[model samples]
Target: MVSAVITAAGLNRRMREDLLSKGMTIEHKLIMDLKGKPVIIRTIENVLESGVKNCVVVLGHYSEEINSVLKDFPDERVKIIYNHDLDCELSETLLNGVKNIEYGLCLCVAADQPTVTYNTMAKLIENAINYENPENIVSILARKETGFLESAEGLGMPFVCHSKLLLNYLPEHKDNLNPILREMISNDVVFYGTPAINELELVNINRYNDYLYIKNKF
Candidate 1:
């Protein structure tokens, strides 16, 4: 069964401070309302709707607040894990979720991306499962350019791969999976990209302005 690992443990240093300055009390971007649902909730629901067998969410920083909202979340497929290191990098948070998954294949998603669609998620999983190599990493690509999949910076989450690949390639110290993914691509590890149907689904909320942009657009 393919499971999903969503990283929601960000410190949100920039987003929190920016929103506070704007006189908004939102503690983190994950809790921000996007089209009537919280960002993280939307992300989780979208992943589940894509037909993953189960999901693991790694929480840190504002874990209590994050957990409070999810306390009554009825979905039995969603599991919550905690990372005590509030200052851990994004890669580490993702790794924490990866380590806890019980499935052979894993889909990596960012909780801040409320706009991500179930259609795009299902497409990514379909591509990964169709590939010959179980080790192949399948990611959603924003552009149709050929070289976009070659670099980690161009590779964003909502990607699918074997759980083993993440256990071996994810670096604990890096802010993101980009550096290690770049190294893996250089080593000829099979990394493929499926073109996103709507690029807006790939947009992530990082700062106050980003939240505003999403709210305004969607």
Candidate 2:
């Protein structure tokens, strides 16, 4: 069995401030509309349409609002878990979802990335299964993602790995995955794959402009 883990616990501080300054009143970025549909729904649709059976969504920092959005999706494979402390870091969100999963392999992704497609996710899962080591994480490499150093190795999420591989390195607090990724790099266990996906799907949206660009393109 394989489960898809989605982390959407971010405060969306940048996105919120950007919208407020522009005279908009959006609070929950994950539930914010992405080309008519909510962002979180669009992201999960990608996973479900990709032929993944099980999905686990970790919610925090305004769980009620996100829950309302999730109710629209009637998939039995979709399950929700809550983080009582909104301050829990992103890594914990990843851990929260995977720890409850009984699957040997899981696909991890960020809910904020709406353009991430099912094709990319499916390819990553295949890569993980064929990896030389079960512990090695199969991650996708993006060429056009912004808001980070261009030199950064992999895009933030959409990684495939065994549950045990992550538990061994997961810390209690990690807003970013760099530390864990660095640890894997030092041990030479990270496998990067360039799947045949549209570069737009890998674009990471943190601000209003990003949303507009994605909206206009797709």
Candidate 3:
């Protein structure tokens, strides 16, 4: 069965500071009423609706606050894993989630990306399962041309290997996987990338302005 690993451990430092200066707290950001429901709650709901039977959420910085927001959700389907080292980088969070998963393939998504639709996720899973090489590391979305035009160009791929590929590389390059993964692709490691139905679903909320933009749009 397919599973999903969501990384939500970041400090949300910028957004937290922005709210605090306005006489608010991090809890406001966690359970903030956006489009009538909490932001992360909506994120989790979307994942559940996406057909994934099991989901593991890796929590850090605001673990307590995030958990409080999701307390009403059923424990059977969604499991919350805490990353005690809140100061660690995103790579650690990704690794923590992978270690707990027994599924052959797992989708790693950023928790702050609440706009991801069930359709987009289904497409990713479909491609991964039906593609010529199901074992190849498959990314759900690709960076759009508009994103490049807007000067947001980088390695536009999403997704990474959960087993053979990532596990083999981590021992030598334990710090970051991006460069190593890229090099592996160059050296002919099986990799797959699919276009997203809506590019906005890939937008990750990092700063206060980003949160505001998403709120205004959706």
In terms of TM-score, which candidate is strongest? 1
Each model's Cα RMSD = 2.0, 3.5, 3.9
Clashing pairs in 2: none
lDDT of 1 by residue, 1-218 (tens): 79999999878889978978889776778887888888889999999998899999999988998998887889999999999687888888888898898758888899987777888788778877877886665555444443236555556676888888788777545667777677777877767776666657757899988888888987
Among these predictions, the greatest lDDT belongs to 1
Model 1 root-mean-square deviation: 2.0
Q: What TM-score does candidate 3 get on C-alpha atoms?
A: 0.82
Q: Number of clashes in model 2?
A: 0
Q: Estimate each model's TM-score.
A: 0.91, 0.89, 0.82
- Tens-place lDDT per residue, model 2, 59-78, is 98878888998976888989
Of models 1 and 3, which has the larger TM-score?
Answer: 1
Clashing pairs for predicted structure model 1, backbone only? none
* lDDT score for candidate 3 against the true structure: 0.66
Off by over 4 Å in 2: 143-154, 172-175
Superior by lDDT: candidate 1 or candidate 3: 1
Off by over 4 Å in 3: 20-30, 145-162, 170-177
Q: What global local distance difference test value does model 1 have?
A: 0.80
